[model samples]
Target: MKNALLIATACLLGLLSTTGASLPYPILPPLFVNGAPDSLTHFLGLPPKLLFALALMVNPIGLLLGTAVLGSLSDRYGRRPLLLVTAVGAAIGHVLTAWALASRSYPLFLVARFGTGLLEGHSAIVRAMLADRLQGPLRNHALSWLNGALHLGWLVGPLLAGFTIAWGLTIPFYIAAGALLLGAALVGFALERKPRAAGPSWWSVARERHAFNLLRHDGLRALFGVQLAYTCGVTAFYEFYPLWLVEVGHYDTRAIALVNVGMCGLMTCSALFAGRASRTEPMRRAAWLAACVALAIGSLGVGHLWVGLVGIMAFGLPHAFYNAVVQAWAADRFGGGHGQGAVMGLLSTTFCLANILMAAAGAVLTLVDTRLVLLTGAILTAWAANRMRAWGSGAMAGLPPAA
Candidate 1:
């Protein structure tokens, strides 16, 4: 029961943070491409696509940096303190984002987004807490719930923005900001810190044992290298699919939100089933799932209405399963002795880096056509699938050697 409560809290935090962070997905592009020109969208006379890409890139860059250290910090200082501190900072970031939007200050909005992403390392922190408590299938199940919560947040954030942007562009941001504070309160009151001996300062620990340290291992290096490519595919789809709708189907904010509901809703359901089949090797399953997801995502660039609908919705199944399989595999194989916070942080850092790479590349590709970006994602994921299968036989046979 206690474990259940903690997992629930972690899921809720994932929901809150992701929802707030993804608010701009359906809203921002239209603001740049279709809405009245403004200081934010037209900064320094750059094209709207470039400006929008910069906005998207800044946050993930911060996330990449923050995860590098925050996970190690939690391992030294305790999860509760790190969670509480970061939540408040992220909430403030939302408020700043709202203010920037209201004032048409693009520079400030970018700064706020970066700050929010930097402090939003709480996802890794919460996952680390679960890793500390649960093992094997229980931990895998809990991570699935957390994964579902994040997908649901992606659905809700755009849904909320789609509905409330009519009232004001900044309204959804304010609502998300308030929700973040509530999440912070929940953390402060509902969760208890596990007692641990404080060994060294967080900075010292962070400096020595950062997120990328795991990459020093040959097996883990190949694992994360595969993950980097896989995540690039995922981020490209997540960040640009709405834009794809806008360009191909002439989708408005409301229409884009409704479409996301279909896809992200499926993802939420699929997450429940993640890693449930114990007989299948996780790496093998992950390879199959990635191949399926690549096909689904690749099909969407064709622009047929039926193809778009089915492709968007069906891709969720394999994406969710793939995420769960990889995370659990990483935990079971590499999480011993090394802090789970650090391991989880490595995953988070890799994801943020993937996001940054895709966003930047997608911007340049979007200038020609969004289909090119989608195709690039599909190709990378297919390559990753093949690579993962190659490594599966050896990795499935044995546990990771010590760091």
Candidate 2:
């Protein structure tokens, strides 16, 4: 019962992290168009384009910092305390962001976002916590559910942001802030504590041979590369997709929000399915991953909104399967005390670096046709598939055949 509670609480907190971060974003286009020259231009001391780029860049960097630091701290101190800290801090950040938005304070908004990122460590932290407590099927299942919560938040947040911002652009932040408080309460009361020794510090972990050694392992390296590629691809879509819909497809904000709902909805459904599927077969893992890469690549090549929706559905469906399979495989490969924390941190760093590059690239590509960006993603996905195949074949050679 206690273990179940911890997992449930973790899932809730995970949902809070993603949904809260995304709330301000779905409304960003409307906000940018309507409020930007008035609210952000002079405050940011950069062109609107440059400010948007900076904002996008900072979000993932903050997440990267949060996961790297907090995941490690959770390893050292235990999940409960940091969970508490993050929840409370996130609540504060959200409320402050709402006020900042009302005041049209860009610097304050950036500060709020940075703080939110620091407190937003719930996803990575909970993932490590589950790794500590569960194994095999249960662990994979938990991760899937965790991802589902993220997608669920994704599904609802944009639409909510769209509608709520009608009242005030800053209003969505208050709603998001309320969710964080509720999440904090859920976590504080339900989560059980299990403290362990502090693992290596970030620099110490970086210096360690095994930490570096994990990257050298052919299979893990391929998995890590795939992770990087997919992250870049996803960030590309997230950063540019709505803009493409507006500019090329001529869709309004409501239309774009609806499309986002479809994509996030499919992703949420896929996570639930993948959670169940991961325990049964590992090669199923590779197949789902391949499917994800293909769909994500294909989505960009299509132009019409209906056709594009089909591609978007394809793009989202295999995400959690690929994620669970890859992470499960990594956990199985690197099983030890604090090894999960280290692996997660490295993965977080890689994805963040990918996000930064993709955002920069996406910003540039928006000046061109977004379709070309998708083709570049497709090529990388193909490269990742070949690498995963080689890595899988080599790594599986010694192990018993999949059941």
Query: All candidates' lDDT scores?
Result: 0.86, 0.68
Model 2 per-residue lDDT tens digits across residues 158-190: 787877777877777788888888887777677
| Candidate 1: segments with Cα more than 4 A from true spot | 194-196, 395-403
Residue 117 lDDT in model 1?
94
TM-score of each: 0.95, 0.86
User: Once model 2 is optimally superposed onto the true structure by TM-score, how far is the C-alpha of residue 157 displaced, in angstroms?
Assistant: 1.9
RMSD of 2: 3.6
RMSD of every candidate to native, in Å, equals 2.3, 3.6
